[model samples]
Target chain A: MSMTKLTLQIDGRSIETESGRTILEVCKENDITILTMCHLKGITDVGACRLCLVEIEGVSKLMSACTTKVADKMIIRTSTEKIKRYQRITTELFAAERNHVCSVCIANGHCELQKLAYDVKMDHIRYPYLFPQCEVDTSHPLYVLDHNRCIVCTRCVRVCAEVEGAYNWDVMNRGTNVRIISDFNTPWGESITCSDCGKCVEACPTGALWPKAVVQGQLNKAPEFISDLIEKRKMKL
Target chain B: MRVRKAKKEAEISKNDPRVKFLANKIKKENYSPGSLIEILHTAQNAFGYLPLNVLQYITKALKLPPARVFSTVTFYHFFSLKSKGEHTCLVCTGTACYVKGAQAIVNELEKQFGLHSGQVTPDNKLGVAVARCIGACGIAPAVVLDDEVLAKVEPQELTQKIKSKLAAS
Candidate 1:
């Protein structure tokens, strides 16, 4: 496949990247590490997390790096106080709604959300905790569910349907009540069509789903390696 | 202005260990709110948390108004203006993990810790939190134990892992 080259300014640093690369990739490649709760690499960009928001010189409102592609002479600001505040608020909203007790969570040490909170220095959540009670489906022999920890990034939904071709999981409901559900809202293990490949669980970034063997504050999932594999595969093609 | 007055009160004491450390690393030149997050991060690393006095010191050093600093600090999830538990756990509840029983793992942890998600244990030994995604979805039902990744875990295994960590500590 032929590639096009484009030049853009990220955080005032001018850099050139191939065409078809999203701003998130460019930023990551450049070591910008934009605050992102969603927009995983190798997966299609859904811009649902809204944590990677940035301000373009000419654009009025902020834009999500995952969805926005770089253009010639485009100027971007990823770390303005305004942008940081926006990202922080989004993170806080996610934390307040669910149970994000990092110390006890399986993903404590390696969790991106926890890291982001640490990175942002969010000591206390100003808002009240919603503690919205949700179901924990452990019927799946390999994994368990903790709805309280979900931030609804939807990487699983996209990866399952798009990357895995299983389409076994999907998000039901909308807004704060949204959650991932199996076929006909059945238990994950009962979903006979599930490949048991464990791709969806691997795609999750939080404790919403994890192998039964991994305890809370002990689960660690790494998608970077998968993204690297996908990148290598694309490069080969 | 309200912002300016807040800035004046946000100075840090020179004798404080965190302030001295920041003073040495964070030059008094070319400060901005954009770098505020980074500065706070450094301070937190050095001081465990961003105390009110530290905020004042940062406001004075960075030449940012106290309200502006406070606002910026409050806006990001990464910066904690208050004290946090010695141990922190982050659970990923993203789509992939959700379908794989991430919720059950969190529930078990909550029950064991006697602290709900996003809360500090009464003894302040641990803090529990949930995040949107950690970019590690392929390891469904992922959790981070103080910065380590334990992927593809089961509920019983999760308990054992925690028990062992506590035992080791």
Candidate 2:
């Protein structure tokens, strides 16, 4: 079946993309900037993070680029004054909602949240720090879960369930009280269902999940490998 | 996969009775994913709390992911994973209740019984819960003791009521 390709204007540039392509995909392919955090390529996009929100013409509220499929002649604005303001506010809120002291974090320089702050040019958080006494679970022999740094993007939960095929991580509660918990709200080290494959640690956008093998500031993660693994699974050989 | 089986067996070993009960319920639901929440409700009603074994059993019997099961259990406040005390007290802390001095009641209870909201007393006689609203906004600062709703409460009087309620239970 031959489908018609749609032409859309984004950031004042006209681009042609076929149907079923997400705005984020088209933007990334054409080198258009669209910031995102909760997006993991192999898993389903829940659009949990509001950072990828873009303003569409004639639409009152913003829509997430990762979840919004490209439509014919859709005039999307990925970067605008209002979008930038919302992005900055989102970054600052993520920083303030949890204990995100950059200097002490394991992800430090390699962290997506830190890079996002720089991308948005966030000098400091204007909001009061919640300073929630979040827990750090060193239960697993190879990984640690720091709730203080968690943005609750659910990437770990998605990757564990989708890619690793081990549905161990999940979020409990709602709003500010929400937390990512291991099987049945048990400690990670005590999880009976976790395969301890480290996919979730690699899939995490922030320093919320990390391998115990690496010390602070020395940790490195390649989230793109998640997509590569998924693609490699398609081959029968 | 062998490791997964081993861990699952170990989890089911201790909680065999409850796990089997949940498995039976899931089977009765015909292993339908749509009935997960309903099955969980029955499981919680039977055990008073949804434990890991029950959740895991539900996952296996329903052929669903454990994360999905765990997510459903945690998304709602109606389901509790922690065991509760003999008597339960749900205190409303909505805007109407707060304006009507709901914090004072919670603080007074915390002081008098050394119990914070959502905590069970050490003796396991009373459990205090903090809820957003119980829909009885007209009766601000409402307290629900078991199935009964007590409206327009005073902190000291509420404390005495809880004490007597616990004593009765």
Candidate 3:
């Protein structure tokens, strides 16, 4: 099958690309920055997090760059004032939704969510703190599931099902009440399907899922590792 | 306690006629994964609420991951994982109803019965809940008792009315 050629302008620069690639991919190739949370390169994109929204010239609403395909002759603006404002608000909400005390978190400086807040210049949250009674599940023996720090990006859910093929982590409930559950809301140590792989721990953007071996400020995760593995697996050799 | 709970759940799945109805519905739908919502509706209707065993049975019958079945069930408000009680009082808290003193009625219920919305009495006789809207704005301040919609309800009379309903059955 031959790849279809297309022309598009991003950030006022004329670029030529092939079809079947997302706007985010085109932006990355050109060194344009697009913020995202629920996107994992190896697996599918659900566009759950709205951080990658970009303003297309003809479109009325902002489109998520990770999921929106690059069309012919499209004009896209990735860093408009409106997009920045929305991104800041989104970052603020993530902070206020649960208890994310960065100073005490396991991932601290290494956390993607904390880094996102710094990038967006989110100093103080305007939204009310939900202070929901979230759970900290230490039943896995090897890992911990802390609901307080989760943003519900479902990165762990996707990576577990797609990369690890364990299908152990899934979200339950909706809105502010939602939570990641293991096999019928059972304790992680009691899961019948989990292979005890730590792929989910690495895929987690926040300190929501972490290995029990690591303490506060000692955590390191490489989501890019999953993407790299996928690329190598696709080789014919 | 965990073992006991599991055993009781197994007993229900083994003996309940409702489980048979749910199984029949699943079979009729050919156990297609696309029919998940429909099967869940049948299961909810037959069982009055979705239990763990019923969800597990559906998951097995459809050959789907337990997580998938659970996520679908929790996404929709129409399905309840817990019982809505023997009798339910659903107050409409939509704009029109709120303007017509729906909050007052809710407050009255909380004060009188010491049970907030989404909560059932200790005896499990009556459950209190609130709806975004019941679409009965023509009769704002509507409350649904069981399946009957009571319109233009007063806050002071709600407790008495609920008590009477509970006493009936």
What candidate 3 gets wrong by more than 4 Å, as runs, is B1-11, B95-114, B151-168
TM value for model 1: 0.56
True contacts kept of 3: 0.61
Model 3, A127-229: lDDT tens digits are: 9999999999998778999999999999999999988888988999888999999878888887767888788988999999999988799999999998998
DockQ of each: 0.01, 0.41, 0.40
Q: For model 3, what is the C-alpha lDDT against the true structure?
A: 0.90
The candidate that wins on DockQ is: 2
**TM-score for each of the candidates:** 0.56, 0.83, 0.89
Q: Per-residue alpha-carbon lDDT of model 1 for B8-54, expressed as tens digits?
A: 33455678776787877567535665678778888888876777777
True contacts kept of 2: 0.51
DockQ rank order: 2, 3, 1
- Sliding window of 10 residues with minimal summed lDDT for model 3 chain B: B1-10
Report lDDT per candidate: 0.76, 0.86, 0.90
| B96-134: candidate 2 lDDT, tens digit per residue | 999999999999988998888889977878888889988
Which regions of candidate 1 deviate over 4 angstroms? A1-3, A229-237, B1-169
Candidate ranking (TM-score, best to worst): 3, 2, 1
